[model samples]
Target: MRDDVRRLLASYEPARQQPDPPLPPAGVLLLLHDRPGGPHVIFQKRTDRVRDHKGQISFPGGVMDPGDPDVRYTALRETHEEIGVRPDDVDVLGELDQMVTVSNFLVTPFVGWLDRYPYEWRFSSEEVAYLLEVPLSHLRDPRNLVPDRRIINGREYVFQAYRFGDDLIWGATARMLGNFLDLLSALE
Candidate 1:
């Protein structure tokens, strides 16, 4: 099962070439676990002080550092730093499709499984504003799932959504989640 999950997430990152304009590096985690109901994932709200995506609900990840070994290492390390979960605690299954954000960042999403829930979490007041351990069932709810259309640089774009409470998980985060659901649906 763990190996399977890893494979699914890994499918998201394709080895592609960006000729003239190279993409900025970023990464995130798509964590999952089968509980009494079904699978679940985690989310966090960025602090208003953060330079980008402030006060918006997001995954616990960030831009890759030069010191990181690879993109996978970047995702694992960022999640641990933001959520206070050590890298060993998360068994990375695979990765999700890479996404291009409006901010021009090319983010790599990784999937992980955690059986033992961590007791406590600490956040950087400068980066994380709120935390949510959202269940996969809740995200799968059609009511919360909505469509979002936009015109970026005169090009029309459509994205999916997962609204949790007052926060709207749309844009890159939501698109990534939507991709996850699409993959899970295929397995069913």
Candidate 2:
């Protein structure tokens, strides 16, 4: 499965979007680990203290620093800072489509594979509320997709979201997940 994923991503050309007056670039790591039950993806529930996307469920990542070489480096650096996963430890598979967030960030999502379980995670207490490890099976289930309605700036909008237990994944993160799941479906 891992080999298949790697091959698929290698040949995949992710879609890129360019908006007028470009948004600041950010990167997120979508980490996959093979556990006892099967493969699982890691997510962090952000604390309310975060400047943007406060109290939201997201992949481990952040805006790119000036010194960062590329968006990929930014993703690895943020993943290490946020989840204690060393950049060298991750087998980076490939990238997914770039997404523009409501917060005005051009987010590049990278898919990485982890070989081990029971990882010793040291997360930033101020940024992360808790870590959520969700099974791929649960996320891939069509029944888990729920309709989410929200009122932003006095306008109502409905979005598709994933509900894993009590945690709701929507917004940019959900869109990224949907893209990845679509790729996985193509492989089958």
Candidate 3:
């Protein structure tokens, strides 16, 4: 898997050429760890009390702080603050293309590996409701991926969603996950 990640990074191409300006920069960490059966990625269900995207399943990350040295550091710092994953513990494989969300955030997604297994996670009560560990194999299944459509202000919009139990991973998080999955699948 490490070799596959390296290969994907080495053959990297930017799908999103230019990000819209005036959007606040944000970073997200796609942290994968080895579980019993296979590699699993961690996600957090945001608390309903939070301001934005409440109750949504998301990666452990947030908007960049002024103190952050760089986008990768922002991701690492946010992950540490949100889920207690130290920056030193992560082995950064590479990054995905920059993505701009409807909420006016230019998100840079970073892919990282824990290198060790069976992680013990502690969640921040102010932000996260609970932690979700999903097997990569489950996401690889075609049946689990579905097209999500909805009408907002009489305009129809569609996006990709991956279902795990009753939870739906959609929006930006889904986009990042889909990209990661695509990268892995390309190696097959």
Candidate 4:
């Protein structure tokens, strides 16, 4: 999978598109690691007490701090802070296309590879509710994907989400996963 990912990313030129400026910059990591059965991606269920996006299933990251030299720094630092993944433990592959949230955040998603399996998680009680692993094969299954529609401010918006167990992976995280899977499918 690692070799395939590298080859696909190399052959494909990511737009690296940026949304309009002045939006608060944030970074999230699409962290994939080996598990017992197969590869899986890690996600955090945010504590309901957080400031924003409370109780949402999200990647382990937050807004970029001024001390962060770049978005990659933001992603690695936040991942380490939120969970227990050490910065040195993560092998960052590359970044996907940037996305803008309805709340006006320019979110940069970074894909990182962790060769090690079964990480010891130390969740920050203040931020993380719990951590869950969604198998890559489950995500790849089209039967698990669903589209939701809603009307907001007289505009109709649709969101694609993936369901695994009782958890609903939606919003930006879902979009990012879709983009990654789309690229992976191109390899076929």
The pairs that clash in candidate 4 are none
Model 2, span 47-69: residue lDDT tens:
99989899999999999999999
| Candidate 2 RMSD to the real structure | 1.0
lDDT of every model, 2 decimals: 0.78, 0.94, 0.88, 0.88
Whole-model lDDT, model 4: 0.88
lDDT preference between candidates 1 and 3, better one: 3
Q: Locate the minimum summed-lDDT window of 10 residues in model 1.
A: 11-20
Task: For residue 159, give model 2's deviation from the true position in Å.
Answer: 1.2
The C-alpha RMSD of each candidate to the native structure, in angstroms, is 2.6, 1.0, 1.4, 1.4
Measured against the true structure, the TM-scores of the candidates, in listed sequence, are 0.86, 0.97, 0.94, 0.94
* Residue ranges of candidate 2 with Cα displaced over 4 Å: none
- Those runs of model 1 whose alpha carbons end farther than 4 Å from true positions after fitting are 1-4, 7-19, 34-36, 149-158
Candidate 4 residue-wise lDDT, 56-124, digit = tens: 899998899999999999999999999989999998888888888776888899889886877788879
Candidate 3 residues 30-90, lDDT tens each? 9988878988989999999888899999999889999988889999999999888888999
What value of lDDT does candidate 3 attain over all alpha carbons? 0.88
Off by over 4 Å in 3: 16-20
Sliding window of 10 residues with minimal summed lDDT for model 3: 14-23
